[model samples]
Target: MNNDTDTARLRKLDQDHHLHPFTNLSRHSQQGGRIISRAEHIYIYDSDGNKMLDGMSGLWCCNLGYSQTLIKDAIYAQLQALPYYNNFFQCANEPAVELARALVEITPAQFSHVFFTNSGSEANDTNIRLVHRYYNLLGKPKKTLIISRKNAYHGSTIAATSLGGMGAMRKQTQGLDYVHHINQPYWFAEGADELPDEYGIRVARELEQKIDELGEDRVAAFIAEPVQGAGGVIVPPQSYWPEIKRICNERDILLIMDEVICGFGRTGNWFGSQSYNLEPDLMTFAKAVTNGYIPLGGVMVGDRVAEVLLSHSGEFAHGMTYSGHPAACAAGIATLSVLRERNIIKSAADDIAPYFQQRLQTLKDHPIVGEVRGIGMLGAVELVRDKHSRERLAPDAAGAVYCRDRANATGLMVRQSGDTMITAPPLICNHSEIDSLVNMLSKTLDQTAEHFNIR
Candidate 1:
């Protein structure tokens, strides 16, 4: 299946049978999608043998890059030893137990327990159950509502999608009535007159206001990503997290940090909560846990919630069949080991991150670039028609879509969220790879500007 004929056959098969997520079915069925046949290090190759830098790290998960023999070998070994097992009915696997312990060790001291799931969606779904169960155990069944920020991306399952604040996601169906949303700390898009710091503070205060309006007793938890990954890497101002912490503390609301994107060293630290100095009561994590080798996600249960849940005598009655699959857990253990032994997270934070961010920042001066913002291995460049006024290039975000396609054609993999072009390169990317990614993106931006007739 290496030649053009085979590639066409595969594309035809996919178009006829596969239903992709977040895709325009009509457009895809007509044009077909590029077939990614192989990946190595920070690059992926199409069926036609075109190599491209993976600027977004395979949807922001392949932090260790594509060819990690350690993780592959671990998965293989686990398959040989204990290929399958169930963590249900008071049973557990060695890999699962060890992986959980490793997670607890690397995360904040408060997180001593873990509840595994197959993906971040399931982890967040577990969060809802756990939060509700905790409140019910404490005889506060009325404390059911969860507060989330608009444009945040938690996951795609029913409950997870409801917990998230994307309006487009909620438009198709009614969300859980218990969940509510507040404005995001997207200063570039939303901060019109106020300073970024002021805007962040104001938006952060919205959580407190919502809690107050809902009568504190009714609000069980407040969830958000440390950095809004799918929401265009909107890094809130320095004043944001502290104020959020204060609000949650003073209001007695559980803080749920969705680290699905920022966990496992994407943000320099093992977790984004650590990067932002946030001490959440519950943290939802996935993606890089196993470096995208296998499906694995879990909640890093903080002592506050863990103690309450543990002290209760009744069973939680919430779990998945693949909650602690042995193979995935083994991959997770191997991934974590590699990250620690190689000091990959630290090196990325101290070395690659600076270079990556510096190169990303250089795009701010481009004629169509309104803003360039990022931290660690994640970043975004906002495209605008009028930089000073922040006028969007297209009302329906078509500009970003066009620019993203251009980037892909130019040999780079990046994501477009609304009008913002985002990238989260693998943590293993070297200076040369980072430069390649940025150069491709720069070319894409220039092409987009010319295409739109921007002077």
Candidate 2:
């Protein structure tokens, strides 16, 4: 940890100038927040020198952990060779071109092209334009409506926010009229009374209902996260994805998988689409593409969309100044190299993931835990007042907020989305680290139960 950091001074400075995202600004300014000064592997040290296991993987991005020197060295090497370059005016940089090729190689066979962006929000914004442009080129200009799931989080940018289905985000700004939303396959909250498979099918059918209501021709595409990450790691039932895929295929509605959080082995696969056998026409990727060491994101354009965009005569007229940044692309290359060379992703899937899921499952017997659902490295524990009846605690998500604070106080970082406590640990965690994480979480849950006077 950095011993020289003046924790109080830094906190004061942050409160004065730094406005955080998705935060209660006034409360944050008054209380301040943990100033993370350093990180190594899966542990982050705050300004006060307190180390905490980062169970949320640094906002669900740093899959390779925090100590990978390869990505850092790669960025330095790129900076030394060429500090900056633009991918406009028929110009291209080596790192950008190479990273694009690497992305295509690792992603599903259908994806043959990539359009880079600086972050997931920009990537999803690009998706909206690309989807509309593709249909316009094919002479179907009216196919502009996009269908998303309720509680789904895409990004915070205006266009990306419009594409998402989060009520709070939508309430902050007027959303685009073309974007629509349907019921999410959140079985624990929305389908507790029915068998999971049956509930999955029923919720999956909502997409069909939406398409029919909008008229199939009027709908441009349906976008969704393979596993709803920000929506509390809501892993849909086994019957969900297949039925959704069938509906998309039968209705001729394009499927856009928002792989921003689930991409790069979070779901124990290179991409979440592969995990659920989803063949989307486009996939939004960010976060782990560079292990969150640098900002880099893009849309993996499948053959169907690529061919149409490529065949069009004129320019697409949408891009960012930092799109395909040389240094960011270099970080991406090095991150992918480490993931492949060390077999980190495969190990996470075949070995670490099973152990992680097993440990998480043990929390199901907790009195406050109504359900424990997870897949691969991501998991969530639903907090309820009555487990048998699935009755949510009063004051909405107060219980989850309490549990999250307790976990943080116990040196474990987790997230609370509504009444669900979610986690996505770094893929590099070993058996011992998994045990520690689970133990810390169990202790936090126990304390929360005691606070609520529950067994």
Candidate 3:
């Protein structure tokens, strides 16, 4: 059979056998699927040869865009030299060590050590273990709970899921406890009446209250994304991060920044912590690290935390077989090189990102829009049933479906997170593409309004 026929058959089989994440299984079975054949720049070509602009940048991971020859060559060379090597005991690879050293240069000045993992989820999971082990080593075995903001997303793994704040993800694990939830610093939803600084301080105070309620000795860390990604692209006010940093420092609680979606130039900086002025004691990184070309993630720990963990146990208790896999490390090195050589991050923020953000803001004038919010390459348009009332558009037939489908029809690929439609074009996107992305979004929003019978 031809390749197209084979792809079609495989898709059919997948419909019958596979269970998709963050999707309605029944709806997926009825709708079938489109097989993406290839990708170049910011566009994905399906098996049917239709090109769609990837406004969400393949789940906000492909920051460098698709088809980077540098990364491809690195993976190929590594595969030829050494396909696999486990980082156990004294055994390790050069690429892993080199990548870690390179990371230390770009990350915040406090991050001194790096631990490798296969994905962002695994990295966050590793963080939990390390945090608990660090406390245990310090003879503070009572510290076990990690505080995370409501609507934050760290990852899908059980421990990572426990640390996440998304309601739907949490519901999947009934009776799962240990992680404490705090109020998100979403000024749009939570700070409707209060001043921005007042709203920010109110949410920041929640962390202190939570620590007091749980007892300072019982709380190990406070983990959050500098800008909540999967939780609807929520960006906190300037007052929030400084207060959070102050609280964590005062409480002696480790501040862990999950930069999975906001890292590596996506937020106009090397890391989100830099953008938001968050001085995290530990950070979980993934997605853009390898530019989604390879499955690789890692955790960077500050000297203090590292010292505690090392003193407690001579050996770390957890690891993945593919941790520091040579091939993935090679891809990461190459991707970082391209990011620097091309100055993609600088160009995106200095030129295209500002233009894109401005265009996105224009949508706020549209009657159907509740709010338009974002930073750098990441943006979200919140659709409300009543813009003045700020009532959330229902998630079922009342929300996401109309906007997402309409955008797809216009050849733009956007993602729906509850009532918010998130857009994160690749950092490599040019001004023309940014214009196209914004224009297409306007069309999609207009069409979505008509579909909802809204004026």
lDDT of each: 0.92, 0.93, 0.87
Off by over 4 Å in 1: none
- Sorted by TM-score, highest first, which candidate order results? 1, 2, 3
The CA root-mean-square deviation of candidate 1, after full C-alpha superposition on the true structure, stands at: 0.9
> What does candidate 1 score on TM?
0.99
Give the per-residue lDDT digits (tens) of candidate 1, residues 1-455: 36979999999999988889989998888889989999998889999999988988898899989999999999999999999989999999999999999998998988999999999999999999999998999999999999998998899999989988888998976889999999999888888789878888998999888988998889999999999999889999988999998888788789999999999888889889998888899999999999998999999999999999999898899888889999999999999999999999998999999999999988999999999989899999999999888998987999999999999889888999999999999999889988888988999999999999998
TM-scores for all predictions:
0.99, 0.99, 0.96
Which 10 consecutive positions of candidate 1 have the poorest summed lDDT?
A: 166-175
Clashing pairs in 3: none
Q: Could you give candidate 2's per-residue lDDT for residues 192-276 as a string of tens digits?
A: 8899999999999999999999999999999999999999999999999999999998987789999999999999999999999
Q: Which candidate is the best by lDDT?
A: 2
After TM-score superposition, the amount by which residue 49's alpha carbon in candidate 2 deviates from its true location, in angstroms, is 0.6
Q: What's the C-alpha lDDT at position 206 in model 2?
A: 92
